[model samples]
Target chain A: MKIIACYSNKGGVGKTASSANLAHLMAQSGHKVLLCDLDPQGASSFYFRLKPAKKLSEDSFFTDQDKLLKAIKGSDYENLDVLPANMDFRDFDIFLSRLAKGHSALKKALKGVKKDYDIVLLDCPPTISMLSESVFSCANWVLVPVIPSTLSERTLEQLLDFFTQHKLEKSKILAFFSMVQVSKKLHLDTMQRLGEQHADLLLNTYIPFSSHIERMGVNRAPATDFAKATPAAQHYLDLWRELATRI
Target chain B: MPRLWHSQGEGDFTPLLSWLENKAVQRGLVLSQTEFLSGPLALIDNGDCQIAEQGKSLLRLSHKLLSISQRDIYPLHRKDQPPFDFPLPPRELCERIEQPPAWLLGLAPLRNLQILARGKGRYQQWRLTNRLHKTCGIIYLLDIELNGISAQHFCFCQTYRGFTKSEKLLTSWQRYIKDVFPGQTAGVSEIVALYRRHPLVVHHANTSMQKGRPDIASQTKRWLKPLLLAAFSNEQGIILDIDTEYLHQYRVNMRKARSLLSLCKGAFEENQQQHCANQLANWMQNTNVLRDLDVHLQDQVTYQQILPPHLHCQADKLRHNLQKERQIAQQRLSDQLQSTAYQTNKQILMQSIAQLNDGDKGQKPATQYGRKRLIRQLNKIFVLTGQLHDQSPDDELHRLRIALKKARYLAEFFQRPKTTKRLSVLASSLKQLTQDFGLFNDACVQQQALHGWLDSARAIKRPPSENIEALTLLLRYYQEQKRQTKYKISQHLRLLNDPNHQSALLAATQNLI
Candidate 1:
C-alpha cells in the first residue's frame, strides 16, 4: 500500500480538494482508497459530509489501534472510505512530543489499515510544522499542490529546502501545478519558469482553475462525482491518471 | 447494509407512512416524497440455476432494465430474447459474476405475478447523533413493493465519520425495526429464492434404482418413467430451438433409459424389449446429426485458436455452412418428433413400461439379476480394456471406451442399497477413466466431423481454399489433442487397471448376488 500526502505549505492551493478528488477517482478505478483527513479544520471530511467522532481524541489517534479502526467510515461510494479528522487533532504535534519515536508514530498508526487500503491519501494541514515533519517521514509521496504563482513557487522551494536540510529524499516531493488560470500573464510566466526549473519534479498535467471546483462545497461531494463532465473534474481525472502511473 | 425483511400482514400503507413520518419528525429529519411507481419484474436464472447457485439474483424490471443491484442496472430492451443473446449492461457486475452474458441459459419469461411496486422517492435520511447532537452517520432506507403492497424493505447505513458510529447506529436501527415489525426479517438470498421461479426441466434428478426394492420390473419402470418424461418434456423446448441443452439433455435421458432396458435383459418380453430398444435408437439417431453439429459449432473458439488469423474468413464460411446444415437438421428432428410414428412409439413405450407386470417371476431375484448383468458388463469391459495397448487401433480404443461407458451406466442403474464406500470409490474411478477415454474418442470424432465437412463441401459450389485450409488446421489441432489425450489415457489406466480396483469392483458386484 502507498501513502500519499496531498500537502502544501501554502493554504488555498487545492491541497484538500486534490486529496478528496483523487481518493474518489482512485476508488472508482477499483482501488480501495482511504482518505485520511489529518487537517484540524477537516475541510476534506466536510467535503465528504463526514463529521469526526469525538471519541477519537489526539491521544487515541496514534496509540489505540481499535480507536483508529473505528474512526474509518465507509463513504457513500463503493471502495472509498474516510478517516475523518477530530477537532482535538489540533494538539497532534503536542501529543507527538510526548511519544517516543514520534517521527514514525504516524506511519505505525497507519500500518493498521495498510492491508485494507490500496492507497491512503492524507489531506494534510498547511504549515511546515512538527506534523509536516512526521508526514515527510511517513508518506511514500508528498504531493504538493502549487497554485502557479510566485508565492506558491517560493513555498515549494521552501518545502524542498526543508527536505534537503533534513536529509530526506527530495524525490518524494511531487510538486504539481494547481488552480491554473491560463488567461493570467503572471500565472503563465511562473508556470513556465517552474516547469523548466523543476522539469522532473512537476507532474505533466495541470489542474485549471474552475468554478465547478468551488461548488464542491455546495455539492458536498467530489467534483468527479457531481460535475463529472466539467473541465475541473477532467483535470483531476488526468492528474489521478498521471499519479496512478507513477505509483 | 442490513438484511431486508418481507412484511406480510398489512393495512393501508397510510398508517405505516405516518408512523415513519412521525418518527422522522421526532428526529427532526425531512422525509422526501414522490409519486408511486409500479412495474412488472421477473427474477431469472440459468438452466442450471447458476445465478441462484452463486447466491446472486438478476431481476428484469418492466422488460426495460435488468438489475443485479441498486447501482448495477442494465437496460435490456429485447425482453423476448434470451439473457445470453442481448448485451447486458453494468459490465463491471458481469465481470464480477465471472460468467459472460451470452452463455446465461434459460432466461425465464416475465410472469405477471412477478411485478414489483417501487417507491419513486427514497425514505427520509437519518442522522446518527451523539449526546451532543453531532452528526455521526447517516441511514437510508429503500422499500420494494409487490402487487401494490409494500412487501419488502432494505435499509443501508454508513457512518459519516467512523465504523463505530455506523455499528452503533445499525444496532440501534435493528432494535427500532424489531420494535416496529415483530419478526419478519429475511435475507436477500432467501427473498430471491422464494420469488424466483426455477426452470422445470432441471439437469439433476433422482434416477437411482435401489437393490432391494421388491420387484425389479416395477422398480425399473419407476426409474425409466421419469427419464422418458424428462426426455419428452425437453422435446418441445428443443423443437422451438430454445436452447441446445434441451436437446443435449433429451439425448441423455433417452440413452439412460436405453441402457437400463439393455441391462435388464429378460425383465420384459423379448419382443417388447427389442422394440423399445430399437425405438429409442431411432429417436437418438434422428437428432444425432444435429447434436453433433451443435457440439462442433460450440467449439468456435477452439477453431479460431487452431487456425491462423488469415484463415478466419474461411473459418467463418465453414461455420456458416455448419449452421445452415444445423437448421436443416433441427427442422428434420422437429418434424420427426411431431410425426405420428414418433408420437405412437413414445406413447407405446411409456404405456408398456408403465403397465409391465411384476408377476412375471424370472429365475433370479432382482439382486441376482442385477449382479449377473453387472458382472457380465464388467467382465466385458475389463477384457476389452485389457486388450488396449499403445499400438492398438483407434477403433479398438473407441470400442473399449464405449464398453466402459455401458458398464458404468449399468452399474449406476443397478446401484445397490447401502453400497460401501469402497464400491463408490471404485465407481468414481471408473467414471473418471471413462471420461478420459471419452475425451480421446471425441478428439477422433471431431477430426472425422471436420474431414466429413470438408468432403461434403466439395459437392457444393467450389468452396474457398481458405476454408479448406482452416479445416485442415482444425483437423491437425484435433490430431495433436488426440495424441495428448493418449498420454492422459495412460495416466488414467493406472487407476482403472489397478489390481485393487479390479478386486474392489468384483467384490462390490459379487456381494449383491
Candidate 2:
C-alpha cells in the first residue's frame, strides 16, 4: 500500500478536510484508498458516518503479526480496507510500549499487505511524539500541508529540520502550500520563498482560501463532493492529480 | 389448629391430657387433647390422640364437612393465610406421599434424577411441589463426588427435568472434585439434623469415581467458585469437546516445535561450516543451554506428569536425508574440486557420514508418509520394569514391543523382499534412518519411565522404595540386554547402505508401505 501520511507539526493547516477530500478523490478515481484517521478525535469516523469501536481489544490490532492480511476488514468501497484505530489509541501507545515485545510491534503489525492498497493516508495527530515517529516509520511518503502564514512557514522549516536531522530520505517527504489567499501579498511572498528554498520539494498545486472548505465540516460531507465543480473543488482535484503523479 | 399440647408437669402431653379430662366431662361430644391432622373433624367421641390418614378412628365424625381423609379433596390456592396453617399431612402418616404415582418405587412422590452443567461450577436449584415451583424448600442434604452435587438444586433438577434447564452428566473427575463437594462449606457439622429436617436431597448415580466416599480433593468445591459461576448461564453448555485433542495436540505441537528448532539450528551451522568459519558459536551456545535444560526435564519427570516431550523425533530423519543429499549434490558440485572419497579408506567413513546426512530430496509423497508411519510403529516400545508393588497389565506395554520389532524387520536389509523397481530403491532410503532411531528410542523410553519412578519414590511423598528398587533393577537388566542387542542392530544398520542389501530392503519397505 502507498501510505501517504498528511503531517504538519502545527495545527489548523486544514489537515482533516484535506485527508477526507484526498481519500474521497482517490476512491472516486477507482483506486482503493484507506484513509486511516490517526487523529482519533472521531473526526474521520464522523465524516464516514460510522461509530468508533466500542471496545478496544489489544488483540484486535495485535494478533499474528505475520497474518496481517487476514485482520483487515473491507470497507463499503470495493477495494478500500480499514484498520480503524480507537479514540483511546492515545492510551494504547503507553499500553503497547510497556509490553515485553514492543520494539518491532508496529513493524510486525504492518509487515504484510503493503501491495494491497493503492494509497494509505494517515491523518496524523498534530504532534511530534512516539505516535508521530511510529507513523513516519511505517509511511512510504509524508505530505506536509502548510498555511501560508509566517508561523506556518516557521513550522514547515522546523519539520524539515527535524527530518534532516533524523537522516530520512528527502525524496519521501513533500510540502504543499495549502489555504492560499492570493489577496494577501505576504502569503504569495512566503510561497515563492518556500519554492526557492526547497527546489522540486514544493508541490505545484495550492489549495485556495475558500469558505467552501469550511462548509465541508459544517455539512459533514467531503469537500470535493459537497462543493462539486466549484473553484475550491477544482483546486482539490488539481492537487490530487499533482500528488498522484509525484507519488 | 394442628398444635401440640404441652404437658406442663411432665413437659409433655400427660398433664395436659388430665386437664382435658375435666373439660370432657361437661361436653358430651368431648374432643380434648386430640391431635388436629386433617382438621377439627377429629371430634368423634375423641380423646387424646395423634391423628393420621391411617389412624384409628377414636370417634367417627358424622360431620364430614371438615375431615380431610376418605374423599377426593381439591387444592385451594389461599393467599394471605395465617403463617401457621390448620391443615397438614400428619407427621407420621402411613405413606409419605398422599397420592402414589405408579412410577415411584416407594411412597415418596418424587424421584431423584442427575444432570451435569458441563463447565466448571454449579449455578442454582430448589425443590417444591413438581407443579407449583415454590422456593421455601431447605437444603436437606448435600453430597459431593467426582462428578458434581446431589444437592437441593440437583434434587429439584431430578424431580423436574427442566428446573435446572439443560443440565448434562459430568464427564470428568477433575471438574467435579474441583467443584460441588460440600466439606468446603462454612458451617456443615450437623448432618443428621439437616437431613431429618429436609428430605429432598439425593445422590447422582455414577457421579463418584470411588463410590460411597465424598470425593472432596479440590480446595474450591463450592459448587459455584467465584471465577466460573458468573460466566455461565443457567446451564454451562460447551460448544464442543475442546479437551478432546487436548493431550494429543499438545504432544504433537511440542514435538514439531522442537524438530523445527533443531533443524534450523543444524542448517545454520552447516551453512556456516561450508565456509570453514565458526560464526555459529554464539547460536550453538544458546542451543546447547536449551538442550541441556530439556534433557534435565526429561530425566526428572515421567511422560504422564511433565510437559509434552519436545525432544525432536524427526532429528534422525533430517540428519539421514541431509547426509545423503549432500553427497550427490557435493559429487555434482565438487567435480570441479576433483575430490573422491570413493578412492581411499577414508571413503568408508565419509560415505557413512555422507549417507546419514544428505540423501532424499524429491522422493514421492506416499514414500514420505510411509517412512513416517513405519517410524512411529517402530518407536512404540513401551515395556514395563514389572517391579511395582501394584503391577500394571502387560497388554499395552507388550503390544508396543511387538510393534517396534515388526517395524524394524520390515525396514532391515536381509528381511526385505526381492524386486525390480527404481521407486523401491528411493523408498527404503527413509526406512534405514527411522529403524536406526526407532530401535534406540524404544530403549530410552523404558529407561526413563523406570528411572523416573524410582527417583520420585525416594524424594517425593511416594508409597515406598521397595517397588521402585525392584523396578529399577529390572529396568537396568533390560538396558544391558538391549545394549548387547544393539551391536547386532548396528551391523544390520550398516548393511542397509550396501547396494545389494539396500535393493532388497527397498523392495520390502515398498511392500510394507
Candidate 3:
C-alpha cells in the first residue's frame, strides 16, 4: 500500500479539500482508498458527514490495530472509507514523544491497514511537529497544496529547507497550485516565478478557485461528486491522474 | 443481506412506493427512485434442474449471465448468446457450477419457455437517504410478466454495510411489507421453481410399479412409457450434436426399455415384443461407433497422462483423428435420426406399445410376475457363476454380465417401498459385479479398436515410429487393465462360490421377492 500525505504548514491552503477530492477520485478509478483524517479538527471527516470517532485515544491510535480499524467508517461512495479523526489526536505529537520509536510510530500504526487498502490518504494537520516529522518519514509522497501567493511560496521554500536540514528526500515533495484565480495578475506572477524556480517539484495541473468548491460545505460531499461537470472537478481529476503516475 | 418478497398481484408498484415514502418521512429521510435494468429476463437450466437444485438461479439479462443466490448477485458471463456446452461458459460461471466439467457436458436449454414474457418496465431501484444525503438502505423492485397470465413483482431490500442506523428502519419495513403483502416472503430460488413447474420441462418420473397386487399390463405401461418418451425426448439434443451425454442418455433409456421388455415376457404379444426389442437394438447399434468415439475423446486427458511427454504429440494426432471420425459418425447419426424412415419406425413402435394388453401372463399380479422373474434370473446367474473358471472364455463372462444386468433391472422394477434396504443391498452387489465387467469389456474393446487402427495405418501409409510406439503403449495399458479386471471378477466369483454365501444369496432373493 502507498501512503500519500496532503500536508501543508500554512493553513487555508485547501489541503483537506484536496485530500477529500483526491481520495474520492482515486476510489472512482477503482482503487480501494481510505481517507485518514489526521487533523484534530476533523474537517475531512465532516465533509464525508461522518461523526468524529469516539474513544480513540492518542496512545491506542499508534499501538492498537483493532481500535484503529474499528474507527474507520464507510463513506457514501463505493470503495472509499474514512478513518474519522478524534479530538484526542491533538496530543499525537505529545504521545509520540513518549514512545521508544517516535519517528516510526505513525508508519507502524498504518501497517495494520496495509492489506485492506490500496491507498491511505492522510489529511494531516497544518503543523510541523513530531507527528508531521513521522508523516514525512513514512509517506511515499507528500502532496503540498499551495495557494499561488508570495507567502505560500515562502512557506514552500521553508519546507524545502527543513527537508534539507532533516536529510529527508526532497524528491518526495510534490507541490501544486490550488485555489488559483486566472484573473489576478499577482497570482499569475507568483505561480510563474515559483514554477520556474521549482521546475521539478510543481505539478502541471492546478485547482482553480471556484464557488462550486465552496459549496462542498453545504453538500457535505466531495466536489467531484456534487460538481462533476464543473472545471474545478475536472482539474482535480487531472491532478489525481498526474499524481497517480508519480506514485 | 437482501430480503425478498414476491407478490402475485398486478405489476403496479405504487403501493410499495407510497409505503416506502411514508416510512422515509416518518424517519426523516428522503426517498428517491431511479430506473434500473429493464429487459426480458430469461432463466436457463438443463433438464434435471441441477442449477436450481443448488439453491441458485442462472438468469440472462440482455447479454450478461448472472448467477444469483439469496445474498449475492455475480455476473458470470457476458456474451450475446447463452452457452449450452462445456468449456463455452467462462471460468467465472464454471467455477460456480457444481462438478462443472462433467455436469456441464449434459447441459441443454429447456424448451417451451413460453411462460417467460418480454415485458417492459422490468426493474426499478429505490433508496432511502438520511439528512446528510447518505443512502442507508435500498429497495430493488423487479416486475415479472408471465405470458397469458397476470404480472407479478419481486421486491428486495438491502441495507448498506456499516450503516447500523438502518437496521431498525429495515426491520420496520420488513414487518410492514409482510403484513401488507401477506405470504410474500419467498427468495430468489422461488423464481427458478416457478419456471421448473412448466409441463414441457423434461424430468425423470418414478417408474416403480404399483403396490398390492397390481395387474402386470398397467404396471408395465407405467414403467415403459417414461423410458420411451425420455429416450425420444433426447432426439433433438443428439440431432444438434451439442454434447455426448444426449446420445449416452438416449442409449441408456433404450437399453432400459429393452431390458424391461425382455424381463416382462408376457406383457405383450410375442411377435410384437420381439419387434420392439429388435427396433431398440437396431437404434442402439446405429450409435455404437459414435458412442465409442465420444468415450475415447472424453478420455483424452487420461490418455495424455498415461503417456510420457515425448509421446503427447502422437496422442494429439490420435485425438485429432478420433475427433474427425466422431464428426463423421455424429453427422451420420443426426441425419438418420431426422430421417422419415426413423420417424416411421418410431411411430410403429409407439403403436405397438399402445396396442399392448393383458396377454396370457399379463393377467397375473405384477408382484408375482416380478418375483418369479427376479428369482429365475438369480438362479441363472448362480448357474453361470458356478460354470466360471480361471480360464473362462470372454463369451462366458459376457453372458454372466448380461444376466447380472437383467437381474438388477428386475430387482429395480419390483422394488417395494418396504423392501428398500434389501433391494439396495442386492442392487449394490449387482452394480459392483456389472461395473467390473463393464471395465473389462471397455478394455477389450479399446484394445481391439487400437489394433485395427494400427493395422489400417500401416496398410495405408508408413506411420512415424513415435506414433507406433504410443499406440503400442496404449494397447499394452489396456491389456494390463483387462487382466486386472479379470482377476477382480474371479475373486468376486470365488466369494460367491462359498456354500454359506450361496444359500444366503438365495435366501435374500427369496425374502425380497
Candidate 4:
C-alpha cells in the first residue's frame, strides 16, 4: 500500500480539492482508496457528504486500530471510503508532541489497514507542526499543490528547504501547479520559473482553474464524477494517471 | 443487502415500477430507468443435466461460457466452441463442475438440443437516487425466456452500501413483493426445469421398471425399448460425424441390447430372440471399423509418445493416413444410416420388439427369471475363474471378460430398490474385473491393428522407412503394455481366488436371488 499526503504548509492552494478529486479518480480507475480527512475543517469529508466520526478522537486515532477502522465510512462511490475528522483532530499536533517516537505513530496506526486499501490518501491541514512532521516521516510521497503565484512558490521553496534541513527524502516531494489560471502572465511566468528550477520534483500536468471544481461544494461529490467532461476533471484524471505511473 | 423474488404468473413489471415510483416520491428521491437486451444464448448440457444438477446454468454466447447461478453470472473465457464430447473443461471451469473426470469425459450434448434459442430475454434497471444523483438503491426486473416459453420475471433489489434510507425502502419493497408475488425465489434450478420441459430437448426414455413382481416379457420390453431408442437417437449424430462419442455410444447401446436378449433368453420366443440378436450384431459390425479408427485417432498422441523424437514426422504421416481411413469409414457408415434399407430394418426391428409375445418362461415372475439367470451367469464365471492361469491365452481372457460383462448387465437389469446395495457391489466388482481384462485386450488389438496397417501400407505403396520404424516402435510399446496389463490381471485373479472374496461374491449374488 502507498501513502500520499496531500499537504501544503501554505493554505488555500487547492490542497483539499486536489486530494478529493485525485482520490475519486484513483478509485474510478479500480484502486481501493481511503481518503483520510486529517484537517479539522473536514472539507474532504463534507465533500463526500459524510459526517464527522465522533467516536474517533485524536488520542484513539493512533493507538486504537479497531476504533480507527470502524470510523471509516463508505462513500457514495464504489471503492472509495472516507475517514472523517472531527474538531478533536485539531489537537493532533499537541497529542503527538507528548508521545515518544511520534514521528512513526501515524505509520503504525496505518499498518492495520495495509491489506484493506491500495492507497491511503491523507488530506492534510495546511500547517507546519508535529502532525506534519509525522506525515513527512511516514508518507511515500508528499504531494504539494501549489497555486501559480509568488507566495505559493515561496512556500514550496520553504517546504523543500525544510525537507533538506531535516534530512528527509527530498525526492518524496512531488509538487504540481493546481488552480492554474493560464490567462495571467504572472501565473505563467511563475510556473515556467518553477518548472526550470525544480525539474525533477514538479509534474508536467497541471489542474486548470474552472467553475466546475468550485461546484464540488454544491454537489457534495467529487468534481471528476459530476463534471466529468470539464477540463478541471480531465486534468485531475491526467494527473492521476501520471502519478499512478510514478507511484 | 440484496433480495431476489420471482413472480408466480406471467410477470408484469408495471405494478412493481409503480410501487417503486410511489416509494421514491414519499422518500423524496429521484427515480430513473434503464433497459437492456441480451443477444441469443444457447443452453448446453448432457443427457443427465450434470451442469444443472450442481445448480448452475451453462450457456454459450458467441465464444464465451457463462455460468449463471442464483446469485451471480461468471463468464468464463473460452476461445473455441467445445465439441459434443469435450475432453476436459478449461482450467477455470473445472472447479465449477463437481463431477469426476471420467463422467465429464463421457459428456455429450443432449440429442436435438445442440443449439437452443433462449436469447429473447430483457431486463430493466430501476435506480432510486437522491438530489446529488447518488444511486441509493437499484431494482432489476428480468424477463427470461427459454425457446419461446416465457419464464417468471425475477426482481432483484439491492441497497447501496452506507445508504440506510434505501434499506428502509428495500424492507418495505420486500414486504410488498412477498405479499404480491408470494412463494417464488427464482433460481437456476427453475430455469433448468424449464429446459427439461422444452419439446425440442430429447429426454432419456423412462427405462426403470416396477420394483416387485414384474412379468418377464413386459420388463424385458421396458428395458429393450429405451436401449433401442437411445441407439437410434445417435444415428443422426453419427451421420453428421459430430464426434467420436456418438459412434462409441451407438455401439455400446447396441451391445447392451444384444447382451440383454441373450441373457434373458427365455423371456422371448427363440426365433424372435435370434432375429433381434442378428440385427444388433449387423449394426455393430457396420460401425466396427469406424469405431476402431476413431480410437486410433484418439490415441495418436500416445502413439507419438511411444516413438523417438526423430519419428514424430513419420507419426504425423501415420496420423494423416489414419484420418483418411477414418473419413472413408465414417462416410460408409453415414451412407448406411441414411440408406432406405437401414430405415426399413430399424422399423422392422422396432415393430418386432413391440409385437413380441410371451414365451413359456415369459409368464413367470421377473425376479424369479432374473435370479435364475444371475445364478447361472455367476456359476459360469466361477467355472471360468477356476480355469484361469498366468498362461491363459488372450482368447480365454476375452471369454472370461465377456462372461463378467454379461453378469454385470444381468445384475443391472434385475436391480431393485430393496436389493441395490448387494447388487451394486457385485456389479462394481464385475466392472473392475472386466476393465482390467479390457485393458489387456485393447493393447493386444491395437498392436495387431498397427501391424496390419503397416503391412497394407507397404502393399499399396512402399512407405517411408521412418514410417515403418515408427509403426514398429508403437507396436512394441503396445506389446509391452499388453504384457503389463496381463500381469495386473493375473494379480487381480489371484485376489479373486481368495476364499473370503469368493464367498462374499457368492453371498451377494445369492441374497439377490
TM-score each candidate: 0.71, 0.31, 0.62, 0.63
Is model 2 an incorrect, acceptable, medium or high docking prediction? incorrect
Q: lDDT per residue, candidate 1, B1-513, as tens digits?
A: 122222222222233445544554565543344223245445555444555555555554443334333222223334244333222323323443432354233243211111212222222334444443334454444344444334555554444435453354355555665567676544345545454333333445467765444466766777888888778867766776766777878898988888877777777776777777888888898888998888788787778777788988777877888899999999999898888988998888888877664434433466667777778887887777677788888998888777777777766766665666655665676688888886787787798998887787666788867767777789889989999998888777656577787777787678744
Which one wins on TM-score?
1
Ranking by lDDT: 3, 4, 1, 2
Candidate 3, residues B1-513, lDDT tens digits: the string is 122333333435547578768867887878888546667666656545666666766665554444555554444533324443322333434555433433334444322112221333366667777787776677767665545345666666666444656656766766776677776544455566676654323456477768768888778888888898888877876776645666877887889899988888987778888888999999999999998887678668978988999999988999999999998999999899999999999998888887876668888888878887888888888899999988888889999999998988888778887775877788888889898998888887888888987777676666767877888888888889888999999998887777788778777777776
Tens digits of per-residue lDDT for model 4, A4-89: 99999999899999999999988877788999999999999889877788989999999999899878777767678889899999
Q: Which structure among the candidates has the greatest DockQ?
A: 1
Minimum summed lDDT over a 10-residue window in model 3 chain B is located at B110-119
Question: How well is each residue in B1-513 modelled by candidate 4, as lDDT tens digits?
Answer: 123333333556557778878878888887788545455556765434666666666666444455556654434544344523232333324444432233233444322224423565555667787765666777766556665455656566656545567668876877877777666656456668866653333335455557767898988988888898878877766877655666766777788889988888878898998898899999999998897787678788997787789988888988998899999999999999999999999999999998887777988888878888888887788788789887778889889889988998888778786666778888787788888887887787798898897797577666767767787888888988999998888787776777787777777777775
Q: In every candidate, how many clashes are there?
A: 0, 17, 0, 0
- In model 1, state the lDDT of residue B48: 46
Candidate 2 residue lDDT tens string, B1-513? 000110001011222223333432333212222122221212211001122213211111121211122211111122333321212222212133333222222222111111111112121222222121111111111121112222211111121111121121111211333243433322111212232222112111111122222212111111112211111111111111111121122222223222222222222234322321221222123233223233323333332222223322222332344345444533442232133431242244223323322213212232333344444443332111122112323343344334434444323311224433533443364345445545555555556655765676677776554445455554665477456545544454445435566446445544653
Which regions in candidate 4 have their CA more than 4 angstroms from the true location? A1-247, B1-9, B12-35, B60-114, B123-138, B145-147, B159-163, B174-209
lDDT of 2 by residue, A107-207 (tens): 45665655556787888778876566666666787888899889998988887787788776667788888899999999999888888987667888899
lDDT against the true structure, each candidate:
0.71, 0.43, 0.79, 0.78
Off by over 4 Å in 2: A57-78, A81-83, A95-104, A112-116, B1-513
Chain B TM-score by candidate, in order shown:
0.75, 0.21, 0.83, 0.82
Q: State the displacement of the C-alpha of residue A5, model 2, in Å, after optimal TM-score superposition.
A: 0.7
Give the chain B TM-score achieved by candidate 3: 0.83
